[model samples]
Target: MTASSTTTPALAKEVALLAVLATLWGASYTFIRIGVETIPPITFIAARTLIAGGLLVAIIKMRGLSLPKDPAIWKRFFIQACINSVIPFTLIAWAEQTVNAGLATILNSTTPIFAFLLTVLITRHEAVTMRKLLGTIAGVIGISLIIGMEAFQGVGKELVAQLAIVAATISYAAAAIFGRGFKGLDPMMPAAGSMICGAVILIPVSLVVDQPWTIAPSADSLLALLGLSVFSTALAFVIYFRLIHTLGSVSTTSQAYLRVPIGVGIGVIFLGETLASTALTGLVFVVIGVAAMTFPSRKKTVPV
Candidate 1:
């Protein structure tokens, strides 16, 4: 057997894992929607990090590995937690209370676009190309359209929520850029460490402000929280790390736009939600723009 025969099945497996990652993350939008109904955003996200972090820790231990002993590494983990989880996760949970799950999915799915722009401006990590420049313009236009279309409805609080999701998208972009600093470490280290650090940061805030004990979350909310913590956050992180290792960051994150449609479908079917015609149009632009940003160019491009 030649090298081509050996590599094909492995490549196919990575692609399959990417699809699974999209579904898990896509479902998280509905989970947050259901959870934030009764659970406050900070408390909900705190629990999510804590539960998922514990699971990752256990997995590491079972593998006969331990988290880094260096304080510097843990400090970096803390920063990662802020951008990757603590801030963005809380923002998404809070926003989902007002924003529909489907819209949240579309808004948050622009990570690669922002990552690309950041690369162009600050990092200069990736090669600039005509396609990427056009992609950036399309993404900005798509976002503007979504917000502008919503404004006609006089969605005051919803506007703030939408912007919050956008900010979360920015945080995700920075996280991706900073995540490159972890190229030499085991992928699970950042995934697990940042989660644990996020828990440490948020749990105290949840107790003091939300007083989560006083809140009586419903069965659906509890179930959603569990699902979000386990399947979406922990398992999805594991799969994402695996894909990043096997498929490369560009390939792994590129498939994330698939979560947009999956999230919208879950909201429509499970939550009985519907999007306005204008919003649907915006979603189309986002998908197309992200495709332009992330899809492998036929032309030669530099990877940083």
Candidate 2:
């Protein structure tokens, strides 16, 4: 078979995986919203990580894959767990108490913009380009547009909640950069280990703050939690890592753009939510910014 012919099927599979991963993550916001109606934030996040961690462990065992035993790697896993899972999950859950899940997902799409800026300003790992700079500015403007002036008048708590989601997105950006440290390790191991570590960290907090044993969650809430853990957390990671490995970071990160429409659709259909025209416009801007930042640059050919 020709190299080009062989590459086509692989690329198609990766695209399909990307679509599925986006859908899973999009559904996560909806599930979190449903779950947090009865389950407290800390307890909900704790359950999500613990359940997902257990499932990943089972998968690893079934596949005969072993996790790394290095203490340093474990330490990194803890750090990633905090930024990637524990902190963000808690913040999003809290934010969802006030913010709509669809809008939160739209705001969260700014992750790549934050990632690019962090790489330029903090990490100095990537050179700052005009395109990326413009995209970053556009994303901020988009967020402002999403949160219209009317939302701020006597709605400080709501604004703060929305900002919490932005903070969560920033944390996600940092995690994406930090995750590069695990390049040599099995991709699944970091995801599984970070989730386990996240659960460990959140357990004490949930016990103290939430005291989940006293609460009886509704059937819908319980089902939402299950879906979040299994579909969004565990299966999504499997597809995510596969796409990252196959398509490279730029293409994989494009899922952020795809997630917006899926999230908005699910929220509108399932929750009977309505979005303002301004919010939709802002979503377009955010998607455009993310696309600009993540789309691969073309190389110019020199005439021989």
Candidate 3:
């Protein structure tokens, strides 16, 4: 068999893996909305991370994976946890209060564009090309259109919330870049450790900030919280690791694009969301931009 044949199969697997990641992340917005309806945003995020962290730790133990014992590595893990889990998790929850899940998901989909720029600018790792540059431009335009159309009616506060969600995407981009540091560690162990640290930081903050014990939620909301903690946060991490192992970080994180469409589909089907023609046009641009940015460019000329 030729080397080219093997590479094609691997690329196919990477694409498929990213698609699964997209589905898991896209559904998270809906679950978050349901959970936050009765649970305070801080409480929901803290508890969600805590429970997911515990589950991940258990899975790591079962798999016999080891976390880094070095203090420096542990510190990095803590930072990654804070950036990837705690900050974005809480921010998105708070932002979702005023924003619908679909719109929030659309805003969050900007992670890849940010990741591309960060990789090129800060890390000096990847080169930016004309196609990717154009795609990133189109992606920004798409996001602007979506935000402009959806957020006009409730301008001031809603705009802030939308920007907060975009900030969460920036955090996610940083996390994706920062996560490269953990290449040598077993993915599960670092993943678990980070969540453990995140939960530690968030739990105290949630208790102090939200005082969630004072408020109780309806049974439906409670169930939603359970689903958010278990499925969205915990299981999602497990699947994410598998994808990361199969695809490189950039490929795996490309799931950010697909999340928006899935969120929109769920909104139309379940939440009864009605998109204006303008919003739909913007959605088309998003799809085009994602396809442009994520398609892996091939080099037929090999270096000797």
Candidate 4:
């Protein structure tokens, strides 16, 4: 079998993981929304990191693979935590308390746009192609369609919350780009390490601000936190890091394209919201965009 043929199956597996990642995170919006309804964002996300981080660390131990003892690796883990989990996770959690999850999903789907720009201008390591650029545009268009233009009705009303989500989107893009540095390690190491680092930072703030002992969290909120911590965070981060290793940052972030539709679909089914006709069209654009960014471009060969 040729290299191309062998590579195809592996890429397909990775892409399938990408879709799973998207689904996990897409559902996280609702989790965050429910979680922040009764729980403070700081405490909620802090617990999320702590729970997810602890779980992954236990899993790593069970596998008989210890995390690297290098301080440099830990330092990188700390940095990744700040960019990937701490900033973005907290911001999104805080934002969803006020801004609706649909708009947040729409806003958050811009990761590829920022990733595309960062890859081309700052990193310049990845190939910058017109196809990828078009893919970036198409992804945004898809998100807007999937969420429906009506989702923007509260945009100006919640300016700060909206901007918070935008900032989170930028942070996510940077995280995907920065994640390339963790290439050599097992995907779980960075996933677990970063979550631990995030928990270390956020827990103190939560203690001071939220005072977890004082609050009585509702059953819905508690369940939401568990869901977010387990499925959307711990498991999702494993898949996320794997994709970053296999698919590159920009393509991995293309999962944000998928998240919008999946998020909306979740909301529709659970919340009794109606799906619009345009949403179907948007999904088509999304598939096209993700395909453009994800699949390896065939290099035209020179016949010798």
Candidate whose lDDT is highest = 2
lDDT of 3 by residue, 191-296 (tens): 7888889888888988898888887888877787787778777787888888767775556656767787888777667667677676677777776676677777
lDDT of 4 at 197: 97
C-alpha local distance difference test of each model: 0.91, 0.92, 0.80, 0.83
Candidate 4 similarity to native, TM-score? 0.81
Better of 1 and 3 by lDDT: 1
User: In model 2, what lDDT does residue 4 have?
Assistant: 72
Better of 2 and 3 by TM-score: 2
Q: Candidate 4: lDDT of 7? A: 99
Candidate 2's C-alpha runs over 4 A off are 150-155, 300-304
Worst 10 residues of 3 by lDDT: 247-256
Q: What TM-scores do the predictions have?
A: 0.95, 0.96, 0.89, 0.81
Alpha-carbon shift of residue 99 in model 1 (angstroms): 0.5
lDDT of 1 by residue, 169-235 (tens): 9999999899889877899999999999999999999999999889999999999999999999999
Stretches off by above 4 angstroms in model 4 are 1-17, 137-157, 241-254, 273-292, 299-304
After superposition, the stretches of candidate 3 with alpha carbons farther than 4 Å from their true spots are 1-17, 149-155, 301-304
Residue-level lDDT tens digits of model 2 in 190-265? 9999999999999999999989899999999999999999999999998988887799888899999899999989
Residue 107's lDDT in candidate 2: 92
1 against 4, candidate with superior TM-score:
1
